[model samples]
Target: MLQDTIKAQLKGYLANLAHPVVLEASLDDSAPSREMHELLHEVAALSDKVQVSEQGVATRRPSFVIRRADATGQGMAGVTFAAIPMGHEFTSFVLALLQVAGHAPKFSDDVIAQIRALPGKYAFETYVALSCQNCPDVVQALNAMSVLNPNIHNTTIDGALFQDEVAARNIMSVPQVYLNGEPFETGRADVEQILAKLDADAPRRAAERLKDIAPFDMLIIGGGPAGASAAIYAARKGLRTGIVVERFGGQVMDTDGIENFISVKETDGPKLSAALEAHVRQYDVDVISSQRASELFPAAQPGGLHGVALESGAILHARTVILATGAHWRHLGVPGEEEYRNRGVAYCPHCDGPFYKGKRVAVAGGGNSGVEAAIDLAGIVAHVTLLQRGSHLKADKVLQDKLYSMPNVTVLTEALTTRIEGNGKNVTGLTYRGGDGADHHLDLEGVFVQIGLLPNTGWLKGTVRLTDFGEIVVNDHGATSIPGIFAAGDATTTPYKQIVIAIGDGAKAALSAFDYLIRVPATGEKHAAVLETAAK
Candidate 1:
């Protein structure tokens, strides 16, 4: 009965089914089985080409199979839904049914060939939450891949239902894919990335090739807008520059709004990241992606070169190293925070705030980010509650004044969030303790955690001069205490952590490094003076 409206919608979609499609829902003693059975029957009654059946049990609990029905009504297992496909995943489920009835869109010749050539039978299990905006793209891509290759089977599972499996796999985020029972990838990726992960020899070969690279004239340590800007600048000057990044896009990848990026207004994170990467690729910048820097070795002398060691055991040498490794949002480690992430608990308000329109929400942090988020959400949401663990709000007085001015905003200082209360589906409320040792509960549909910024400079702790908070300390020129090392972006002591500010800092670091390379001579080498004389 809960899915009655969805069933009616699915019936409308199945009306034009040209070929027979059979659906088999595996039932158990669970209540979900009865719900699925009723929904399946409702769907079957709509189209003569549609058939529904039931099985006793399946390898995965609460499973359903969709296949092309033959003349005798028998069908082979084609695609499986390990959980009920609802919310964003419902669109993917509908597409899969249409594809089963010979209404699938045609893919490129190259892509089809590659999928068809994939060797052996590989089972792909994609874990997804109901509210993730990016999960649908990944699920649809996998569905198409499954259609192209019979040897490859794709199963979609709702992360909420299979809590044991999620915890066992340590899945903190959604849209995670497991191939043949091994962790393959997390987050949304293009078709090429999926294929690369499926290739057994691709990773080994790529690592071996990365280990053979020569020393670069300039090296950028991250791949955010800052690193991208630095790489573009250095490469334009004909410097051999390389950017090493765990994920090309850095913190900007998780950002959702880009109204502040100058000259261009109203863009999202993924699009801007793509543009940044594309611009860098236009030049000869060696974009070394999916690599994390673990250790930094400063040069013994000026122009001698520094060394950066990656977690993959590949060491890279550079004349100058610009640290652009951006920071991650500090998460609230309370119970249900991780469990309900993207379900109702979100970090970036710009990314997930629109989903909470007209819903009551809580901002868990009274700092600048938290206060700003509250001010931003007050106009959109039904109500806003700002919770701070400290005795007073850590935000600027101006921001505090603005938040107080909002009619829908409520501030609670000296409040510590103890637990986020949510059903397995989504967050329902939050429990916190006040300064008086009294506990309080707030009914809320969403929670935004924005306490403070933590720079991604732990690796440079002993290598360079860092502040007490572990942020890399740099001068106006973005130059660190080490001559050949510079830092920029959120990792540095830059006052503002905005994207535009980071880009400007990146340019400054690149120019400063270039100036140093031209003016200072290496130990036991004297090319700098000769080059200076030639310039004169």
Candidate 2:
């Protein structure tokens, strides 16, 4: 029976085989030849999955033949083959295989039942790293899911084979999946994540829901210190201010206690964030939280200004934009990192340090932030273990001296955190092994990672030029290479990421934006009025 099933699946795949057609195009042409090159590369990756007749011509035959163990020679039970399944439509290929394999799709009862019961169009694309050991499980799971519902079309791709395609689509990591050309998940995601993506990507059926959004005088893209400062100043200027943030407090929310922020004697991160939100609300600032800006484009032809598109399908038109989208804390990328986050594990000392005031806490990284956080937390926290992956601390002498002077602060050089242990919801402690082979687990309430930050500018690919370090390059007045689109705060290559520095830069960007708008009218209202009078 198994052999018969395998043979049946193989026959289905063989019947759908397609011969790949290649076209030679010049790079110096007016047309988009680059797109063709990407398609060719995608085809090449499937060379192993399909039978090749020529250099670029391949008969898209079943790449693999599967047979059931119990089937007889006359009748085939189970068999399957995968063709070139990558790029934007890779998920469809996966679904096709699942149908042939004769297995129900692996999804929740509601989703599976809905797919089985309803009659509608469902499209999806899944990207996966072929070399990744964990990818096949996800692929098989998704295949099972596709089989349960005939309406769903799934596409799969070998992530490594399509470098140009990945680059064009701005994919950073795999299994970086997408639905309907928008982001879905990245790296070893579960079924729930995929389901959530499907729900989010579902098209809206109502036209009346779409309203004419008002153009903003200034649209800030982050809710961190930089974005908040920009929003405050821009609102004061009486411009229609709007701040779009994926998270309200940005990386600062991870901090336990913020002592560096000017004027605040001693404050926690949540309190500071609340205050900022309240202050912005007092003005005419419209703060939209938990929404990411997916794309940015010129508002008018000939580069009049820029507009932003949010993940929620909201279109934001603005005369000026301040990209205060700050940076995110670097992670250890080790096991249990995600599981321990916000429990006993944390990214900011300013945000979570107070919770470990009487208990022990570990601070990873030896940089300035690490040193500063350790020094500040040493006074309040009972014991502080500063774990440095390197041999030495990369902070200033004064800060280093203060840290060493504290009897409770123990600087562990060449130490790396391998795993974090927690009590389900919160972190209980951590396990670390030194370069010298000394393993230790300290009983602690929290762990603060003070590693450097990575700017959240991955979405700015092709739209804006960034520095080598992925930071948005801007001039002294926060004017980006693209006019009318300025950037401030940590996301920009403006050196310091301190609150005071970010505030000053934010103000400068606002003033510069105001100046640019006066010189270049975005709506062409003044020019249109002049033309109308001239016609009269």
Candidate 3:
């Protein structure tokens, strides 16, 4: 199943195993099981510390559990892989093997404590697809949690391979997690978010823990390209840099392909996010994850520290703050959209497109995301109808040309989606206004809403100068209205919201902040004048 180069790489990685590890497989007389059997034996051959065995505890056939050789427990006490765990999940599988063999997982001490202290028993089943970029985080998080705590058990299921279970449970999205046989979450969740869900007092504990942190010379409010870049530059300047974010990758985690990142020819979102985080770790930046900023308080006096209040009820102070909160996918706020979210109205075509195989679907928008989704769906679905709110497609010429060349695609310009039609259980069609000033509807099984992104600067309102569309207004130097405050990436007034632009803008914001720090006096209380000058 694995390539020769991949096998050699796995051999090198598995050599880190501190103790003997057993691959306990419960397989059946099926082709996938036969393939899995061959794969496990091949892996066991690579590493002396690894071995394969059958007749181990298992509740699901065609599945395996990575466990310590001396473990004594039930089937629901360790990391189980019900899927092939190839593609995006391969890293997670390798990590599970190492972690089970006494290799430490990459998690904070506080999170590790939370996982070990989790009360009661938890049986987590995460359904994922191999192509899903967002599944690895959830799968790896659960696997790590299970390895840390004997009471927690996690099983990763491949939704595509197990089509019967996906349909029986009505699972339509990737990274769908179920706890103790009931649905827990239907989307991507980091380690902190999952801990917060299981432990009711987690937020209060986190708030208390955050209060002890000393004020940073530069604090970044996001963890995307902008925030990562800013952290690197500020740390290089010998400034005390810290990053407080809800998630490390932001919307970049949801992205798939990135061919326009300057140097690297091609890379995916998760891979790029890992590189960004790894790069940031090389510096002295204190990276905090899964804590959202609820409010922004400007510096009281010139060169004074700015206060950022988090949703966890903790307030952090910093001498300079960078608002690189980034953006999220804009939704079509039409009727029945939310009601049938998992049933039909979906946002990520890569995640939910497989559920509508051989069925007609509609892609709402005329931009790159919509056109790309339409082109992708043309191969799997019977037909794809792309609706553009504008007179013409706003996508790049190459994408538009490819979309127009598809045989199973129909494009409608100047079309506005009015409502998402659903039959309570599943999506049926979509209603839209045609270019001819008439109401039109298309019969389809699913709708993919991919208009654009909405900047995540809602919390900065009243604290910083903002455009009417909620983007933080900034100067060419990336400084916001307040002297010590700055913004970048999709949340700022930058014309382009590309990753490369965000990276360069982040460096600019960091330099601007460092310059402001040296220029302003510590006791200079000129907040009002700076605001006035920034307004110009």
Candidate 4:
């Protein structure tokens, strides 16, 4: 049954829809199909702009063919909804109807020209999950692109309904886009990224021109909050700054909820990432996207330029460098773990814990992160099972005390997670072994692997003095062992890994770099010219 308030709201939205739209629902006699049909029928009854019709033959299971409406409420050349479009995708579905009705898409002239120039027919198969909050961004972006270009067609498939396809394609996360038959980008890819992917020669062209780039005053590595903040701060100081990122937003893009960013009480990862990007865009920071730094060459002499070679064969030289590359959660390498990632398995409890409210979940490992995640999940979920393979928990005494005090928390020691079991679409449960070598099975909604974090510093092994754990060693002023190069955020030796901490780290690094630039005399007038330009 549809919520009355939601139905009312949708009715208003449908009434204001400029172009006519029809819902061609095709369902079998199955319970799920019948339920979906009734839901659509109820929705159609709300507004004259929306009309529903039943089809005898179903092209896909419990599918709805949304199309442009004629005077008689008939449509053709429409988008298909293979499952009940709920969660974040509901808005995308509404927007798609509007797009089909001849509403002009809001794309810049540059993006429009790129889409128009795309050769031949290309199909964008976007896979989404109803619960994924960021799925709509990619789906809507593709939908808008489809409307602007005649050669491009977009189809959205609900990953939950097409579990077989999800498993076959190894789509661990939502908003996974497939261009033609090959796998394209994952997660929320911007329209520019999509266009770049569409253009096959873009990488080669970018690679060929890498050496022709100008040097910058500050070259910030990574595009996470720290890097973004550093870039903005450096740019505001009138320094010619540039940021190189494999993808913008860094690890923030993979995250979900961002609560403790100061002043902001609530915000999702994608939203916060978008804000960070938008803020950087307002500055004069040169954003080099979709490129990874392969090598870092420190200055041979004092006040000399430090050069970083990118994977794209482009080398960027800067007087100062800031390392804000973040870390990623370490996975438990168990069977089905990778397949069910973001399905019935998750890493960040802060990000995905709310999705499993009132459901049973497990936290692997007994480290500080594991115990903390278990404590956090116990508040929202019905129960939290903490699994530790070691003989003793590695978390602090205070954290262990808090975890023990929680009634909903269950602690299992000397346990090994043998496998993660899931139904093709969602995680059903998991198999583990107890201390006595006895097998145990738990019917859980989700599993959170919180073994630990691995800092993204493999590429900086030789260039920087790193701790044994690969975190860059830094001082109180965010200065690394090497001069003219500073480290910040999760990539540094900062004890705390919070967003606010990372932001402060970024500010510190940028300020330290500015101080170094003022003291050091580098070779050539390029740096002087940049400073002069900034002064003007």
Candidate 5:
């Protein structure tokens, strides 16, 4: 009876209010229980004006249908609630309603209209840390997107909510957005980037019309040695595997020759990549190239974890994900560096060294990579100049000794490359500053930059743990701190960054992922059965 009284009062309050009413539920009130029950009926009656649903509680279908109808109506006009928005997400939820109501502080009408036209159901969940200043912008962008498409529902969960839905997803940071239960965008995403994701995730007519389907077994990002190797091993083990890469070979595409890969005496990088691709293709692996992974998120819940998202704008679902994007060499931003790239300037000496054979080349940097490249090139090239910006070389004593012993190698201490001198077609030479503050010019055919490498983990912010240098930190078994997500290859913080080591790490990661799948024991029964049959 008390519940009935409070429900009447609440309805009267909402009916008379000039603006949308915001109510905070209090767990301490005995009247709240009665009020909540009574409120549900009142909310159902007001279904034409407002919508309400509980997140943690199991609600009845009639109540939910009424709430959804009201929500959809409000959504058409740009108004909706997060139902459980708290902590850092509280502000975002309110802002989302305002943006949907066409009251957003930012964003133009054109962007909003484009978002509204987007097809398919999209669930956008953003995980954010309280300290992120740019998070509001992301929220605004999402709200604008919601305004464009009422089907796009945006949910902002604070870092603490990991105890609920996010903990199961294994999300590590804030401002991490998940679409349809998969991590979509981490950190700040611009309007264009978000729209691109929506386009990628919009399903085809056939997929859109379908109701129920099974998720993928494995989703491998990057088609390099690690990704390809993972796909091959997983497929051989009878798991349905899918691989997505911006390009087939990754950084290895630029590699001209690779002598260190085991069993193969010496082969070109492209050939090795092609062979790996063919090996995986012979199995059940689905290879997708010229596509980039734009997002990753948790799929199911509790024990078994899986998720899906897009590369560019194509939505893909998978049970497991292996990130093997690999590492990219840091570039020295100088004039003509881009034009001379692949012609006279290169990052990988092992890949492009043969082209500079019998010609003068300058190796930049003072680290082990530079010294090693210089030593290796001294044997093949006619002359090599090791340029060190520091006063002394930073390589180990053994490499330093080897560099000194090379007759054709010239050590230029405190030498800093100022410009890459090259014609429109090819490199001719370079200018540098010597230790004595004197300018020096080297007439060279190639400039091999053996500087440090940067892992492709920038997109992972707020989603996974990263080292100070931005490499993904993994355990001994290649398992990242984020459960169900494994990383390998040069992108990891492992000591050895060689092709052989990367392959070994890839194998370990694949095995670790397999173990995770086994522990879950939910979906892969067919795969396990297939494996057993093959063994027999």
Candidate 6:
């Protein structure tokens, strides 16, 4: 049940309903059903525009459908939530109610139009955990689509509440989506990504929209802490700034706890990302999300535009480019790793750890990430085997001590993952090499890879100077080897990749770029010489 303060807030939010809304519930004699009934009763009391009805039966018990009072099935397929939408999903539930009650969703016109014109019928059921930070976006998006188009129907199911269905489908990850009873996608997916999967022309249409964009004074390729900071600084300097990234957060979106950010006592990744994005939007920066940059073409001349190609086949031009395309979790590259991915192999311990409750699992790597994952899993999983390639754990002494205190966790030094063993459907165990150089198998239900991260610099090959490990090399001012092109964050040679460091690096790169822009002549060349002299 919602608290008094939360109920007051919910009542305030429900006042925005333009039309009367009904919560049609189907209940059974179960604890969850009783809880659901109580929640619905409390919610209906808070708003005159909202009421609960047990008249119409739903497909699932302890579930309800949000529908407009005047709308029929032909107009809109109601959005369903099969369990208590608390934790990270509370916002999703509230948003769905507002969107279904004639309030327009906060999305671009083009995106909304695409959803309304979606061709075929889609019955989507997304399995999510209430604790998952990334699940609400998917649930809310699908729910919005259902409100937009009658042909699309969305059911957001809490995996913990529907354990039987999750086990039957072998769904071991949060936000596991199914379309028309078939596996569709797993992990976080935005509106654009979902549309790309459903519509054949979505990509082409999206690319065409960017074909006529005007060149910007500063273009940032990434939307992590680095890219966001750079965009804000550039925009504040009166420079025409833009951002081209698949998502605003990149790797930061996948992060869980972020207590190290200075000035902020404690925060999570999504919250921090939202704050940064809100700050950026206060300026005149153009953010092109759900689009990944695939190629980088340097400027042909000083003050000339640099061409940045996207995976969607669209190319955007900018006067100065800031490379902040962050990094991603590095896979073990061992056999069966990819094959069993999401089938008992996962990288995010926070998101997928609960699915392995009372089960055995293995944590790969010896660094902070691996040790932290092991410590977390120790509370949920039955047993955890920590594997480290080095002779000793590289985590801090405090973390090491905490990990060792757990009786359910075991650490193995000089252990290198060789292969992830599975029975074609789910992971059965894993093979690793000990200090004796002999491979040994550890039986487990899941394998959590926390080895490290690799920079998102693969697309920059042959375009700019990169280290052997594929990181863009930069000086103190964040200037890369190429002129008019700066880099920052985990994608660059900057050491100690942290959120605060990335933000500082982004500001430095923006200032350096401004300095270059003001001093460089509009000649056809000599841009590289300016960078060389500045480095000296």
Expressed as tens digits, the lDDT of each residue in 254-304 for candidate 4 is: 655666678999987777887988899899988887778877878766687
Query: Which scores better on TM-score, 2 or 4?
Result: 4
Candidate 5 whole-model C-alpha lDDT, 0 to 1? 0.64
Pairs with steric clashes in candidate 3 = none
lDDT of 2: 0.62
Residue 443 miss distance in model 5 (angstroms): 5.9
**Which of the two, 1 or 3, has more TM-score?**
3
Q: Is candidate 4 or candidate 5 better by lDDT?
A: 4
Compute the lDDT of residue 130 as modeled in candidate 1: 61
> Roughly what TM-score does model 4 have, to 2 decimal places?
0.74
Give the candidate order by descending lDDT: 6, 3, 4, 1, 5, 2
Best by lDDT: 6
Candidate 5 local lDDT, 1-536, one digit each (tens): 22566456545544543234222222222443444445444544642334443442322111111122223353453323322333333355445434433354454454555576787787776655433433554665675666566676564444432335544664433456788877688655656567756676533321332223345577788888888888888888888788876555566654545777888899765567657767777898766544566555543352343443443334555657788989888888877788776567876665345445588999998898898889878987999998989889999898899899978989988888989997666789999977788878889888998878889878777666899988988999888776678888988888877777877887888888888887875643223322232244
Clashes of each: 0, 36, 0, 0, 17, 0
* Candidate 5: clashing residue pairs, number: 17
Instruction: Return whichever of 3 and 5 wins on TM-score.
Output: 3
Residue 337: error of model 4 in Å? Answer: 6.2
Clash-forming residue pairs, model 4:
none
Whole-model lDDT, candidate 1? 0.79
Full-model lDDT for every candidate: 0.79, 0.62, 0.88, 0.80, 0.64, 0.89
Give candidate 3's whole-model lDDT: 0.88
Put down candidate 1 lDDT per residue, 1-536, tens digits, no spaces: 43668767777888767688888778787877776777667667877888887862567768887887762322235568877776667788888887777675455465567677888887889988765656766787787787667777788987767778875775546677888898787777756567766776544555566766888889999998889889998998899899997666787776655788898879767667868888998999887766788888777678776778776557777888899998988888999998898678877665456567688999999987899899988987999999999999989899899999999999999999999998787889999999999999999999999987788888777779999988899999999999888988888899988889998988989988888877887553323332232234
Model 1 — which ten-residue stretch has the worst lDDT?
Answer: 525-534
lDDT winner between candidates 3 and 4:
3
